[model samples]
Target chain A: MRLKHLLASVAMSATVLAATGAKAVEIEYWQYVFETRVKAMDQLIQKFQAANPDIKVKQTTFPYADYQTKVAASIMAGQGPDVVQLFYGWTDNFISGKMIQPLRASAFPAADIERDFFPIVSAMKRGNDYYGLPTAVRSLALFYNKKIFKDAGLDPANPPKTLDEFVAAAEKTAKRDGGGNLTQAGVTMDMTGQDHQWWREVLIRQNGGQPYTDNDSKVAYNDEAGLKALTFYIDLQKTKKVGQVGFMDEGQAAFRGGLAAMTIDGTFRLGSFNTIKAFEWGVTELPANAKGERSNYASYFANAITTKAQGEKLAAAEKFLAYISSPEAMKVWLEVVGELPARRAAALTPENLANPIYGPFLKGLEYAHTTEFKDEMAQRQVAIDMVNRVLIGGETPKDSLAKAATAEQAILDRAAKR
Target chain B: MSATGTEAAAGGLWSRLSLSQKQVLWAWAFLAVPVLFYTVIRFWPTVQAFYLSATDWNVMRPASYVGFENYRRLWSDPLFWQVFRNTFAYLLLGTPISLLLSFVVAYYLDRVRFMHSFIRALYFLPFLTTAAAMAWVWRWFYQPVPIGVINDILATFGLPQQPFLRSTTQALPAVLAPAIWAGLGFQIIIFLAGLRAIPSTYYEAARIDGLSEGAILRKITIPLLKPTLVFLVVFSSIGFLRIFDQVYNINSNDPGGPLNSTKPLVLMIYQTAFSSYEMGYAAAQTVVLFLILLVISLVQLRIMRDR
Candidate 1:
């Protein structure tokens, strides 16, 4: 009788395990570990699981610095996330590496994506197949400390709108000690940071120069306009003396510490900046050229389904990707992460456009250019070296610009060959 | 019943074997684990690297034989040469300076009795700390004017502020300083152990002979510490040659940046492999580094072993 009882129980437990194994499809989602982004993803996951009871999503995060390396190593080993978050700049690399698969047109139609989302989202497109979708987008704007402006005797409400006015305000607000070292800077200059983007996308465009041509595959920034743009950037330190490089080591740090009056940063900084209660800050559109033409650089982190997902897991991943890229998820991402929604309908609402802190950045999206980078890190390093040559190496701007163009052209050529 | 049958069969075979053969079997059993481990873990990957070095394996596409192309590219690459110089700079300067500093501290600290362990712990604290954390602290120290401790001290002394990490000329040394400091603790401990192993009677005999302190250090302590010195020289030379962590972390905004002034060979290999995903090219660089390390170590051993 006891043997019969054990047999019955064992059969019952097997049935229960089989039932669960059939009912649920589990997929892993991965992203870099930014506090707000992780929190937002968790909330999204909770909502997703509740609505789709048959699917379970597991979330994994790695530090931003190590995220790419971790993703590559794990995927190469054939065990990693089904859905992974990647920088839009890395979409090409991912496609070439076979790390991710293109989204099915039935699930994500190319025409619908182009009509609904901002035009910049097309950076993820290659031959009518989209590899990824972004929940939010980021663009550059000038962040100014209102308290510093007031102390410097400039109207806090009247921020600079033109390049000449911007430089004038910077010079007026800058404070220097007896040693001629700036005690407080008018602006922060860090080539290693977003300054490279500001110079390449905004300054060069405003100066009537195209940074790249030939389908964004060739260097065209070696012209006269490029020389002018580079010179303007260098003179901010050498001639204007309004700010110094390496003054607090980082540009954002100087602005955060209230030592700099103005800094050009991206919309992603909004979440962190909102946390600081020491002083109030305001965002404004980047200063325009003499002709009132403005430019900005836009970028985003996108989510894609990796090649590892198949059959049931692939179906679940498709559902998860669609849900996250929906208007509702974009709204949640905007509220929590301070990045703009990718879709025009979701981002261009009346209330969102009128928001004082977000208005300037939202306006910047209309004219922003998304650089189609072959290798974003390598390209950024080229821009950095270009600036350093003029600033530290004491080279001429014309020479530096020519050298940079040649170097960047070589990188692009090499990438094209691959 | 089956176990007894098998045991009886094994015993019949074992009884026929000679004593030396039995001992040889035991030794083979003992050697198998480590041999298997090294084959799988160390030597296999090394051999694969040599093979992969001649192929164009970008991790995404299937590998194709590119023989000598990667080596030829590395030969003409200016950045590789710069990194080569930076790596040698770390070895030539870092090894000697770190050795001297650790020896000095260990030599003096050996005689101290008051709060000795506490002081020794303080010196060793940096070694135990993570390189990432220690590098960040040093980065902060190199910041300018109102933020940096070093610059603040410079201001007090009426000296001009130095652009330590920002300047290409100074960034290498600035990075090397913390690396040398971090290794000092371990080197000092080794030196202390070596110093303690020396007989106290030799020192007493030296005192009786009226040898000066300088003479005692030069003749007695120096000669007795030869083994320790040789080991440390080779060990630290290897350490300095492959220096990555401190340089990578300090000024992380641009690791080996400001025009690649502080970039070392290891960092270049890392970028080429991971960032650019040029696995074959990275493998070629790795083979070069392996040869360099092998040659340096062998040379060091040969020179030191003779003297």
Candidate 2:
């Protein structure tokens, strides 16, 4: 009876081993994406699973609002995912702490990937350590309502070339249907989310102001350029009334309402409004200021490997990252989801050049610059709130700038302690 | 039994140990598990929060003791004061409006309603719908544009669209209107139960005296419902004090947008902690807010006692 029981236990152990061996390897990915990118991500995951036959990808998606919290909290817990979606700004936060594992030359080699992307993509790298790879390149462009411009006796073919004209045209196009209330707005320069800081950043940058100092010593938001940008926005709300209501989200209701002639927003919002039929719209470059400088805002997501993941799992993750970032994959992503290609090679391809969806943004890219992308994650929250205070809270330019500086200093101190 | 024998029997009760006593000890052993869990999960965190408030700590770094510096910052900060003012204003407006509206509707519905339970459930719909979704729906409804419901209504009335939630002067009041709406259903049900609990003889006595319906309601019903009214006032004040999501969702971190008009204290606390990453200062703001609410509640209770 004892011999029979031992044999039965051995058989059960063998069955358990077989079950464990058949289970698929799990890979975790995190992102701040929604809609088409989310769907495309599922498709990409399915495709990779079929190709590998052993790896199973698990995705944790949050809206952009929660993504920051999730990343910081997880990283702090020392238990982040096997692979993660990173914005260029977060590179310093993770990499400088040696929290992220860097890839060697063989695992993408830098050269095989370096020549493909814009200079901004390399901004995530520090020395010889490559912390991330570009997933998508997003930049701001001027989207104009063609129908509104024609009604305002402005040439739809020729948008404003200078900041002065842009302001004048914005004011001229604004009209009151009754009782000094705006029936149609001339411009939408700001909002609360993703690109709220774009136009302001561009104008500030052009006026020889930096959101942060050159060495990142302190917030330089109170500089001349910052004041000028703030004054212009205040004038739009207070004097011109060309911008709809106060506070951009409430104010810019004119754009989506088909009343605003032009809006400076990221190219990503184009997909959200691709099927608008009430008004004919077109894209163009942001107008230059008197200093002959112009820029649209830029920000993007990247693919990064984790420190904890090992061996075959790491290899599979890298392959999946590379495949999604490939020229062909970039084409598929852009065609279906309306995302800009992270790779310059993909963006400059014949198919992409001829695509009508990308026309204005492509025109605008020559003058594009990044919004305040920070290395230390601590600075991000303060800077973001600072923008909120200025663009939404309606704090005076000086006060807002001072708040940003104070907040930024606190963040820096916290980061130093970390 | 003799008297001495009875006295000996009474003295025998003082003897230690029994089978039932041993069983009771085993039952007490069973209760220890949940008590330990409560200490760890519930009581421990409350105690830890007190200690954390005295220190300068981000999640990653070692917590440095800073004594009462956070509280000191709370005293001097204008943003903290603004949010404090906003929260108080929310309570000041929201409580009375909700209580009055709930009282009226609930009283009318209580007298005669088909499917009483169904009517109560229907009135409680706002409480049932998830807060986040309702806040989003209200966001669009409160918009100050051609698309907003109120603006469309104004257009039909031949009036210009007013800046409802975005105006400095109008934003707080306009935001309060939705909160008042959202709060009505729950308060209504509470009042309905209270009204139903009142003795019918009081109404009958009022009728015998030839009291008018309005007169009996004003004199008896309201005075009788004071306790329920107090309950709603306290709960609603707590709700309005933590006014984060509605304001946060409406403006998307532009909570006090339009010249710092709508930002509440709780929203400021959240922004300071998570957005601005000033946890120490945020904690200070929170401690101040908690004290403010506590003092107000105590004052309210004292005044209520007087009445």
Residue lDDT tens for model 2, B1-307: 3567665886666355587986786687798899899999977876676677788765433468999988877777676677777788888887877887888889888976688888888888887776667767877776654457777678767787776665667888877776777778899889988998899999999999999999998999988988887777788878887776777666663555554578888877777677645567777776777787888788777666535
**Model 2, residue A412: displacement in angstroms?**
5.6
- The TM-scores, chain A only, for the candidates as listed are 0.93, 0.81
The alpha-carbon deviation from the true structure for residue A100 of candidate 1, after best TM-score superposition, in angstroms, is 3.3
Q: What TM-score does prediction 2 earn?
A: 0.79
User: For residue B263, what is the lDDT in candidate 2?
Assistant: 87
Error at B16, model 1, angstroms: 7.1
Please give the distance, in angstroms, between residue B18's alpha carbon in candidate 1 and its true position after superposition: 7.3
RMSD to true structure for each model, in Å: 3.8, 7.4
Return the DockQ of model 2: 0.16
Against the native complex, each candidate's DockQ, computed on alpha carbons, is: 0.42, 0.16
State every prediction's TM-score relative to the real structure: 0.92, 0.79
Instruction: Judging by TM-score against the true structure, name the best candidate.
Output: 1
Q: Which residue pairs show collisions in model 2?
A: B256-B263
